[model samples]
Target: MRVLCATALALAAVVVPALTAQAEQPVNLGSTQIVDTVGALGGQEAEVESALNRLYNATGAQLFVVYVATFDGVAADESWATATAEQNGLGTDDVLLAVATEERIYDIFYPSDFQLDTEATREVENEFLPLLSDENWAGAALAAADGYREAIEGPGFPWGFVLGVLVVGAVVIGIVLVIGRRRASARHTAELADLTKLEQRASRALVHLDDSLTTSEQELGFAVAQFGTEASAPFVEALEAARTKVGEAFRIKQTLDDGVPETDEQARAGLLRILELCDQADDELDRQADAFDELRALEQAAPQTLVQVRADAERAAARLSAAIEALRLLEQRYSSAAVATVEDNTEQAEMLLTFVGRTASQAEGAIAAGKSGSAAIQLRTVQASVAQAGQLLDAIDSLGDRLAEATQSLDAVVADTRHDLAAAKAFQAEATSAELSAGIAAAEASLAVAESPSTLANPVARLERLTAANQELEGTFGRTRDAHTRIQNARVALDGTLATARGQIVAAGDFITTRRGGVGETARTRLAEANRRLDQAVSLAGDDPVAALAEAQQANSLAGAAISAAQSDLTSYQPVGPSRGMFTGPGVSEAVVGGIIGALIGGRGGGFGGGFGGGRSRSGCFGALGGFGGSSRSSGGSLGRSIGRSVGRSAGRSSRGRF
Candidate 1:
């Protein structure tokens, strides 16, 4: 009974919607020994009818059979069979075998006190279900009739009918094998095409990175000549590291192009390796290029750059007051945690602006005193401070917009969560598992909180809560859903997840760009990785949405870590003194130099490595002693009450499932 309940729950999750949609009016069997709605028994209908008549004569138990395209909106096969049986006034000695051919489901139902209990009925189903699978419909019907006869009158098995079924089954098996082969061939062709595209992409990336490296090498030479070896050493090291990666990529390419044959998996791995190496090389080169560009700008136009920094500082100062006012307004409407990310943004911006002002004054004095080296250092400090201040101000200004988007997303996810709860309830109605019931109750409680008016004050947190609750509910029935349903659910969730990921990535990227002076290698590395993953998610969204959703969620998490790491780095950062050297500044490591340089030189140039590639009836002959029967029962009884009772109780002694 427990097993039957669980199986019903599992099948109910998947088949309910389909059953409900295709449901028609109740079909009344009404003394008909055989009702083949779709002609499932073919030309042997009379033979199957004859067998049923023989079973009735040998044992007074009547067997009523009904075949339809589907259960006509009934939630389960057992329920449909029971309704049809009772609707035709089938008595204590009667049995009903109902088949929904299109759905590949059938059930055998008899009175609870009938001679054939659950185990006996299971035996009856085992006799005919295999023939049903072979589409020997007439054979299946005959087998069922014989099974009932054997149960009542002792052994008289039909070996002749079994032999005929075997012949038909062999033909079906051969056809299935041929179809399987064709599908296998199609899959192989698709794999080959994918491999070819990957290889081509890797080759293109290798060529582009190689060209960019060459150009970067020339730029590194110019920097050394202009700034001397000590100042240019970091760029030199960065270029060497990039060259090492590019060289490795070339080796993989050469191996791939060699005469040595490789398996498709091996070739794919090699191609991916090539792409990975190329991306690493480009990142290394760009980091150095950015640092080099900053050095060049400072050295060539210190006075002009100092003027620009001052102007930027003045503009940021003007925005600081407005940002503070906006934060205060937001604070009144939301909780501290809701606006915590930007609560101190205005204060940070004001402090940075003051630091910039002092630094700029000192830089001007140094320039007046004809101390070029000291002035360059002071100007660089002022430049970085002004940029950080602008970022702080921007953060405060953007918080309201982010909150608004979160509120909208919260609404959408709440609706999705409710839909999940409805499905879980449907499954619970069929099986009533304690675990499933607890999950549904928990999710419903979460939804109650999430839908409260106060939840709007912290919409982001509410969204997370609702999403988590929905996920827990999904886990309860995740294995029960068909692949198509699972994929469709993923696609629906993906849009919001991707939007969240993109928003976080953009915010983190802007922080890194403006405050790179304080951000360290780890944060920058994570940010880059997040961007790569987000690109991959977008590319895979149409074809593999489950994978895409995973990737997007990962990107969101990584971006969050990047934001935390960058914020921590900024808080602990100390402005380097002029004594550290003209080129050295806070947060500027060798890898950072390489990243900046790579960006300056490769700036969206075309080529392969140009950017991150987003990657039955049995007929029995009538027995000689078989006699025909007239109508056995009136056809006036309603199926509604019988169906209601079946739905109300746990399934009883029945053998039921898809063929």
Candidate 2:
């Protein structure tokens, strides 16, 4: 029991110290030197602090090295480091390297704000921890600083050798694995669906990325040759970046193959990352290639673009000269509104020529400076200016032609007006119709207005007025001639109508007189009125044929009515049998009675003629004197001749100059 208790006490002593050690207080970091905390760094302080200061200056980060005889914590080295950093009020731009000398444990705590990648952190831990485990405190400190510097500076050496080493190692490893697995003839089917496809797609994408990088390098080389190395520097740098990205893609692919991740999801993720890198690299390569191609094309086209622009400018200048000269001539010789129009257009054209000259100069300078796109833009401007100058010249010529046409039209107007006036005067002299006299007067008045001095002051105004006058005179003369012919025809028609009315009146009077005892007072009165209307027609015929025609028509109607009435009365007065002889007769007594009634009605006809201060010629009464059918006999021939002479004389006196 004593031996067991002693043994137990010894074990307790050991266990209690360990447990207490595990619970020891974390160092008060602020109370110590921040650069070399715990004072355990000793003579290595300057070297370590210098390295850390350099890192801070380069990366805007602070570095701290913490040393302790021992630390108490179950957490990882980095977790204590983070707690120490936070308790000490270390900023986010700070880094802490915590070393526990007895435990051979070190932790690199990055700031919560400034994160370091796992690969670099693992590399640093891997490199420095070995020296710490060996108890080489100074050497471990130097290694930690070196590791941080190396991590910050990147691989510093060329990656090509590393890539070669990895490739050779992978090939050797793959061959060994294959040979050892060859004895197992059984093939394992793939468990996942997308892993094989993912690997293949990743491989293809890497190949495409390599191809794109190679092509971009070649194009960049061509651009350098064409545009000089100085101008192609940016493209070269971009091509180099693309090539580096391709190498990164290859490394990621190799990682997938050699690492052969434990899970299909991990394998798929690796392949996807590789593919994404390849795509990004490909985009950069394509962008750089396009830029190089564009630069080369511009370099090749610069001189020709300049030459074309200069030529266009010269042509524009020539066109402007021509346009200005034409405008000068128009201003000097033409008195047209178009002259002012041409002047304004020529000014615009001249300004365009000036612009062309300046743009052509700019194009020449751009060609000298090797900027073909700018030169091309200026050349287009020159071409547009030349087109505008040509348009302005065309406008000038068109306006001149219009002015010439106007002048010619003015002369034509004057000549046409004179010809129309002459025709109008001739028509007036020959026209005997009273209706045409007023029309002739109106035409002459229009011509006088056209010939007025005030109207002739402006040629255009004169032309307008003369054109109106010419149309009026021509129309008036045509109407005057037509009126003369129409009135003559009307006169002839009136003569015929009057003659027919006289015959009808005489027939009615003869019939009434032959039946005087049988005819009633109404028949007698209608016959009297018919003779009076026939007399009025004879008076009106020579002066107003239209009025004479109307009067003649009325007389004809009255005569027809009188004849019908007398026939009806005679028929009514006649007896049905032997007693009808008391009302009507065909004897000398009836003839004597008709003769007396005819004398009375003839006096009434003469009175109608006398009231109008006109005497009815014998020819006018020939129809009445010949009775119903008198003019058909041989004895009536001389009477007919005498009647024609008397009618002709009366017409000569009445129609001498009336029409």
Give all TM-scores, in the order shown: 0.34, 0.32
- What does candidate 1 score on TM? 0.34
How would you encode candidate 2's per-residue C-alpha lDDT over 1-659 as one tens digit per residue?
34533443443332222211111111123422233323455566546645654564455444567776455654532366666655666554456677766665565666533545656667676787777667666666677666776677675676669989888999999998998686443332343545787888889888877777776777766666655676668777777777777788777777767855557667777788888888877777667667656555644676775576567657666676677777787676644543656668877877887887787788788777876655555565576787787688789878767766766786776667667667666766776545445555655565565456541133344456566666766676677777677777778788788888889988988776655544544456666766787888888877777667767776776677667656655554422233222323665443234334334333434311221123452324312222211221132111222232122211000000000
Candidate 1 yields a Cα-based lDDT of 0.70
Global lDDT of each candidate: 0.70, 0.59
- Point out where model 2 deviates above 4 Å: 1-319, 331-343, 352-391, 409-413, 430-462, 491-497, 512-543, 546-659
Specify the highest-lDDT model's number: 1
Error of 2 at 253 (Å): 63
